[model samples]
Target: MTMDSPIPLAIVGVGKIARDQHLPSISRTPAFALRAAVSRNAEVDGVQNFTDIEACLAARPDVKAVALCLPPEPRFAAAITALEAGCHVLLEKPPGATLGETDVLADLAREKGVTIFATWHSRFAPAVQPAKAFLADRAIRKVTITWREDVRRWHPGQGWVWEPAGFGVFDPGINALSILTEILPDEALLRAARLEVPENAATPIGVTMTMGIAGGGYEIDADFDWRQEGPQTWEIAAETDGGLMSLTGGGKTMAVDGKVVSDEPEAEYDGIYKRFADLIEAGESDMDMRPLRLVADACLLGRRVAVEPFHE
Candidate 1:
C-alpha cells in the first residue's frame, strides 16, 4: 500500500447502506479503489462480487482493506476473518453484538498489526467538529437529545432490527450518542433508563434515559422512539454557561443561543472514508466504543415495559 497507489478495498454487505452511502463514498475517495463486493443479493457493476466474506477474501487477495456493513450478530466474525487475512478493516457503528466482542476485535487487530476503524458516521456530520470546538471552552449545564423516527419508513422490511442484539430504537439512538459524545467536553455515564419494548420484539421501541457527565454535574436527557409518525426529529441541545449550543439535523447544523451557527448539507460517509484513509496511512486505528457502551449500560440498567406489538 504505497502513498501513490490507491489501496484495493472490498465492501462486505451490499444492503441499503452499501447502496445509499458506502458505495458513493468509496467512489468519491481516491485513497481507496473498490475491488470487490460481498453480498448474496447485491452486486457492483465493473467490480468483482462475491457471495460472502470468505469467498471475497479468497478471490480478491489483492484487497488489503475492507469495509463491513453487516448486522451486529455476524459483524465480529466477518471482522475476524478480515483481520486474519491481514486487511485493514472498517466496521459500521455499534461495532458488534456486544461490548466484549468489539473489545476482542480491537485486541485482535492490535495483535495482527492491522488497523480497524469502528466508524461512527453521525459523528462526521459537518457541524460536529465545530460544535466540539465551541463547547471545548464553555461550561455545559444540561444536554437533551430528541431522536424520533418511524421504523417502517426507515427500516422497511428489516426485521432483524427488532431481534435480540438488534438494539431496536438504540440502533438509530446510538448515532445521537455518538454525536453527543464527540462534541461534549466531558464523558457520559449512564444514570438510569426506562425502555418501552413491544410485545413481539426483543428490543425497545422507545427509551428515555438520564446520563451524568464526567467531572461535572451536567445532566443528559435522551429520548428515542421509533413510533413517531409524520415529522421525524433528530436534535441535541445543551445549555451552557456561554449560551445554548445545539446540534440539529443530527449534527449537520449547529446553533448558539438560538442562532444558527453552522448548517451544511451532510457528507458524513465521505468524512468517514477520509478518516479511514488517514488511519491506514498513519498505521493507527480509531475504534471508540463509548457510544455502544452507553447503549449496553442502558440495557443493563433499564427497566422494560411491555407495549403493544410492533408489526412491520
Candidate 2:
C-alpha cells in the first residue's frame, strides 16, 4: 500500500500532551499519519488543523482513527462522535468521568465495528513488562505506592486540573493503578479511601486508598499528593516470593532484593503508537477500562476530607 493509503489519523484536543507525546510518536510510526488536528487554539505545521472536530471530519472523511487527548470530562462526547463517524478511537487516561459513559462508548464501538482503545500510557512503560513477568508466579502479600509531584511543575498553569470534573490528584494516581492492575495476578477492589480536596477547589489535591485482591488477599495502599516540594517520587514496592520487588521512577527503574535489575530511559508513548499500529494491522481493538473503573469507584466510595485551599 502507498503512504497516502495508510491509516489516516487525527488528534483531538491539541493540548500539551498531544504536542509533546502523541505528535512525536505518531510521526515516527509508519502505521499512521498526522492527517489532521482538532483544537480550539492550536495548529500543526503542515497537517490540516480545525477549530472543531466536525469541521475536520467533514473536510477529511478518509481519517480512519482519532486519538483523543482532551480532558476526561469532554472525552466521551468526542469519542462517541469519532466512533459514529466510522473511525477508531484512542482515548487518553481516565477514559471518562464516569465508568457508565465509557461502557456506552465501548458498546457503541463494537456495534459500529470500529476499535476503541482506552489507553493507559503508563502501562506501556519500559519496566512494566519485566515487572509483570517477575511477579507472575510470586505470592503478593502487600503493595505500597507513593506518587507525589508538584502539579504546577507537571501540569503547569492548566487550570482545568483543579476543576470538579478534572479528577485532579486521581489523574496521576490512576496511572499507578493502571500499572498495578497489569502486574497483579488477580483483580483488585478498593477497600477504603480518603480524599483531601482543597477548600476552594472542586477536586482533591491528595488521596490515599487501600485496595484488596482475591486469592490469598493481596493488599495495596496507595498515596497520591500534589504538594511535594523536592524531588518527585513515583514508586511501587511489593513484598512477594523470593524477595521484594520494587518499581520506581514511574516504571523507568526496577529492583529486586534491593539490587537493580532494570533501569532505562522512557519510551512509553513510542510503545503506545507501535501497539496502536499493531492493533490496526490486525484489525483488532484493545480497550481495558479496569483501571479507570477503579478510579470511578474510588470517587464514589471514598471519604471526602477538607484541606486548605490551593492557589496557583
Worst 10 residues of 1 by lDDT: 1-10
Which candidate leads in lDDT?
Answer: 1
Q: Model 2, which residues run further than 4 Å from truth?
A: 1-5
lDDT tens digits, residue span 1-312, model 2: 123456889999988898899999998888888899999998888889898888899999989899999998888888888999999898888788888888899899889987788888999888898999998989887899999999989888888988977999989989999999998878989888999999998899999998897654778899999999889999999998768999998998889999989988898898888777777666678878888878877888999999999988
Question: Residue 74, candidate 1: how far off, in angstroms?
Answer: 1.0
* TM-score, cand. 2: 0.96
The per-prediction CA RMSD against the true structure, in angstroms, equals: 1.1, 1.7
- What's the count of clashing pairs in each model shown? 0, 0
Worst 10 residues of 2 by lDDT: 1-10
Question: What lDDT does each candidate get?
Answer: 0.92, 0.88
lDDT of 1 by residue, 1-312 (tens): 345889999999999998999999999999999999998888889899898899889988999999999989988899999999999999987799998898899999999998999999999999999899998998788899999999999999999999997889999999999998888878899999999999999999999999997665889999999999998899999898989898888898999988998999999999999999999998899889989999999999999999999998
TM-score of 1: 0.98
